[model samples]
Target chain A: MDGVMNPTTNIISFDLTTTSLRDVNHYLHHQVSPGNHIDIHHPNGAHNLAVGLQEAIAVDIHGHTGYYAAGMNQLASVTIHGNAGAGVAENMMSGRVHVKGFASVSAGASAQGGLLVIDGDAGLRCGISLKGGDIVVGGSVGSFSAFMAQAGHMVICGDAGDALGDSLYEAVLYVRGNIKSLGADAQIEPMTEDDQAIVANLLEQAGFSHNPNDFQRVASARQLYHWNADAKQDY
Target chain B: MCGIVGLLIKNPALRDSLGALTVPMLIGMAERGPDSAGLAVFTQPIAESDRKYSLYSGTTVVDWGQLIQALHQQLGGTAQIHTQGNHGILTANLSPAVVKPWIHEHYPAVHILSTGRTIDLYKDEGQPAAVAERYGFSQLKGTHVVAHTRMATESAVTPAHAHPFTAGEDFCLVHNGSLSNPHSIRRMLEPRGIHFDTDNDTEAACRYLEWRMQEGDDLKSALQKGFEELDGFFTFLMGTQDTLALVRDAFACKPAIVAETDDYVAIASEFRSLAHLPDIDHATLYEPAPEEMYVWTVS
Candidate 1:
């Protein structure tokens, strides 16, 4: 049995296939310091695996993870090799987190910073109230995604959920797949050359295999900010 | 998670005295982050000499009693050190770098989280109000401040995992969402030498903005780039020393409402939170669009 130690600049591996994840996290909580590298192998559907870590550490989850996998993260690199449960990476501040598989509901809800990448499908309310940061989803997103979003950009490679970009302010939505419908005050605009270039650059950065030219763009009408009491009569 | 309240005011006296607002705000959001709470208010930028001394030996970590004694001895009796649970806030002639390293060395078990020019972090394990009272947030004062309450569903419930995280020297972020692909993004940014702390996705969002800002992009442009680059559902709010920015995902799954008038602009996760504000004349409140951002600055 490896005894726990103080925060050190070392590379540690937390393999859950053989041992429990709680023990690993507990052991690492005291021993792992900022600027350390921690690799978690065979997570195997663990819940709330990596919650609050303040150290500048690196964590790689090898297998699928349960709910709230990486919530309230500060400065750390957490990578999930498989799908994530609801509220994955919730309320993250600084650091980078990556998910290679599908994501459940409320993904990146009210996220302040960092870059969140989902290579697979995303569930509901993705990027809701997103103040800042970037979210790149390679697959389709479920319903009510980005509802009442104040800021940030959401890129969808597959179909989008209902009420997409509803009540949005200045964020940009780019979708490569078929959009079921546009949400309130959300309009589909022509992808200009610049828009296409942006999509291409994002695709390249996300390592997406798809062609950027196929994607479309959606944005807020900016009319909601100036609500015309008379305009309501038209509706 | 935890709670944080900070204010920036034009009047130093008012700024220092206006800390009372933090008490209620922290109490209101107590359930959101049931950890510790802290408050900080700065009248102006710290002096260079004070900043220099605060950078090195002055800000060493110590217990509440010891910290108070040291503050009194080193910076005279003007320093204020407030502690609650495992978290606390110290306001004196000190720099963030100095305070952060001291916290790390002495309170290694407690998450130092972040330190900024005008912002100080303190958190433990309880409701926001409890934490606030424990840290003497009721006495804080500033023109503007931000706080958070945590519900630890997505991440671990530790003092370190709190909100109102610092993105840069003058920027702080609060969120209510999750990042879908944090690993790949982490891999992408690691080579760039950006350091990260927690495993949560919010940090990734902060790093992304820092990266964009470092590349000479303004807040708006950097946020736009963030929309196209990052993945997953999210609703976020960011505050700089001078500006406040809000963003929602393309799908717009979560809920965020904005209320604005000629005098002030108010935003909250639920509309009820804003209904009690005083003198909200000619207010127009509505939900933000998906994949959109709303920015407010001092006019």
Candidate 2:
């Protein structure tokens, strides 16, 4: 891929077919100031694209990415025009990672901060071990989503697979469609006005036209917060 | 971590390029599985009376033509050998009951990989690319292919332990995850007089599913029974003479992606392994859901 800078528009375009991933990642890490627009072409399911970005820039990828694309982002907004593999926006301190197509497993795992938006379905463990981040999926999320989540909010515009929000802590989940089954210590509570407002805001950010009122809240029952010997591990 | 790839050409004319397309998919998974590799191809069936046995010489060289001559002289039926590197496929009109023991008694070093009417399998302890080249995989023509690149999470990295494990006629299975209860499954099957070729956990799973099929269960029913019996993580891809099937375990920790077009249905452990497929940009791509059966057949 030809890695070149356009003098007129102030855009840096890197073609993966001609440019090595290391070179493009090197430029993304060491070069470019804030507000720069980067275009990556022909990703072809390559892994670890646009990771560790610490500036307020815009990066757009044109094709499918393998794994861990846009991981550990600080302030950059990255958009993948095609499907993304596992861990699309993991451990982001802050930023926006948008997938135009489906996302594989662990869409936003253990993120301290960021808004991860997926326009299509997400694979298993969508938000497993989440910590202080917001995830909005336009399509369904697979099983074991939000397992042991510590903080942040998740909004699902579609159905959820088995075991949604197992061992959740503080983090709230809003689903607009059916949840096949709930995990241990995870219950569906009534959606309040404040929760609706948060879902509305997250939906707007995610560019989805779904109504926030259709969502239901899923959170921790807090039963497993303390051990009781008589429970015998039954939920 | 291992990688499993399967391709079933929907168009009859594209079957010749089966191995040509599958080689890239296997090589793309090099990082996930580097220690060993195997491929099983379901070619056109010869006839009901004939059986094709895939034999490996295992780090040793032998006169393949002489082996076939010896089989003809001893068994006195139609026998032929197709030699490729250290592997030979012996097609005989005689039953395995007459052929297997004779080969064991005469050619003790030759190990059989699979026995079927339409299957020929090759496996070795080497890099995936090297194994593919060593077996001339690019020239293989078949209705479907089930291949594996193993990371050796269990069992030794030997030719026997390489995946695409076969159990019965025209059937093979490749796995990409570990089985927690393989010993239990083995013990369960062993009392039934089922013999195991390797201690590899995938072998147990392969044998279990094939055993279920042998016990009057259809492929889908056998797979459903497998879901109830096989524990731990897995993303299995299997191939029969005319079918290719894929299934992931509950929890679905191991990744799997399927790209289906009018021409082909490609299954891989990851999307990158399928990126180079024809018309892939426009193919319908989706991850196989957990505990779900996806089966495709040749038309």
Candidate 3:
């Protein structure tokens, strides 16, 4: 395998089971360049696999990843063929981070920029404090996701965690699943024409194969900001 | 991770006198970006001729206290120097260029991130509260201000790494997102003489805006170009001498909400941050569209 491998070439392949997690990160950090494409096979729960990279390289992790799999990534297209663990893509700044299987807690937490795609269920705080980025969860997301997102979009295909988009400001939350309840200051609103288009496009991008018309939009009620003595009494 | 708070008002009553609210606004969101904080305030543009004889020459950092002392001596009264973190703003009668050279000579490592007639910067490492207390930000008075709290991820945690980063004379940016193409973009911009202080993606965003604005594009147009050219997920809030703008990527991966009323426009990571504001009743709160921009100018 060593004799056949080439480091400088644009196209790279990784047999995940045979490769060390450290090697993967090192290769991604120092080997691959921008606009490069890579493919992976037989990845089985590699931990801290790809963190803090700044390139346009593409990697397909064939199976699940362990904790903090793609934390703080700058630019790179990572497609996990299976599930991911806690803090997947945490604080990612730019590029695309994709997970084909379920994800653990804090997916995309405090992420400044980038796209995080969870094709299956995601645990807590998906897109939390997301400064700017798009998070497309094809399935459910755990509670307290997007708690204080300053700006960005979060789209869930399945059920959502408790307090979805609580106290949200500047960021938009779109979900197609059943919501147990809205978090503080969150309220359901009519989807505008422009919003519908956005939902449709996002749905297509996430490969959801669902109707955008069926999804309901939720946003901040804007009531907390105006709380007065009278409003306090109602609360 | 970093928390950034910025305010810009178009009302004539709010300009140049915004330091009072600016300090609190930054302190309020101190938890989001708690590593360092800074503030810059700008008055109306000054004539270029008048700047030539000023005490500070070029854009450089000065011994803020000593400079303030000299200005006070020259002006013959107590000059107000408002410090927040490593950055500070002094309202006094002095030339920025003359002060620039002195700062460069004495505090060579102290980067004068940016300089203009109206805008001055102060920043330092530590939590927002610490920086604020050390710099005496509570007493600052200005029409509009921007501050940041930082949790280092892709870059080092230092005073120089703080937010409200200036790209040019009057353009500054606070960002929440990573630029996936920083290496390529950096290579493209560096050869053109654009300097970078940190490896954070926001720096790329700053340089991107600077490059765009330098090509004769207005802030809005430059931001639009950012939306079109820049890649990855980002919700960028940028400020100029007179305008504030917000941008989301094509995918809208980040979170941002804007609540507007007849009297005020409040934006934050969470609705609760703006909860204290009166007159928020039934406000129209909505998120900025992905790949779209919302801009406010103080003209």
Among these predictions, the greatest TM-score belongs to 2
| Model 1 regions more than 4 Å off | A1-235, B1-43, B48-61, B64-103, B261-263
For all predictions in the order shown, the interface RMSD in Å is 12.9, 0.9, 15.0
Error of 2 at A148 (Å): 1.0
Q: Give Cα-based local distance difference scores for all models.
A: 0.66, 0.92, 0.69
lDDT tens digits by residue: candidate 1, A1-235 = 3432236645567667576767877755666777777777756456678876667888878766766887777788788987776778888786767889777778887777766788888877888777675688988887777777777677899999788888887778888878887888888988899887777776776788777678888988877888587775753
Ranking by TM-score: 2, 3, 1
Evaluated on chain B only, what are the TM-scores of all the candidate structures, in order?
A: 0.75, 0.98, 0.79
What DockQ would candidate 1 receive versus the native complex? Answer: 0.06
Report DockQ per prediction, comma-separated. Answer: 0.06, 0.84, 0.02
Q: Write the per-residue lDDT of candidate 2 for residues A81-107, one digit (tens) a residue.
A: 999999999998899999999999999
Q: Mind giving the per-residue lDDT tens digits that candidate 3 earns over B96-210?
A: 5455565457556556666665555666777777767766666655445556666666777766677767766667777766678877778889999887878877788888888
Sort every candidate by DockQ, greatest first. 2, 1, 3
Candidate 1, TM-score vs. the true structure?
Answer: 0.49
Question: Residue B36 in model 2: shift from native, Å?
Answer: 0.9
Which is superior by DockQ, 2 or 3? 2
Candidate that beats the other on lDDT, 1 or 3, i.e. the better one: 3
- The window of 10 residues in a row where model 1 chain A has the poorest summed lDDT is A1-10
**Model 1: per-residue Cα lDDT at residue B231:** 89
Looking at candidate 3 chain A, the ten consecutive residues that score lowest on lDDT are A1-10
Model 2 regions more than 4 Å off:
A233-235
DockQ metric, candidate 3: 0.02
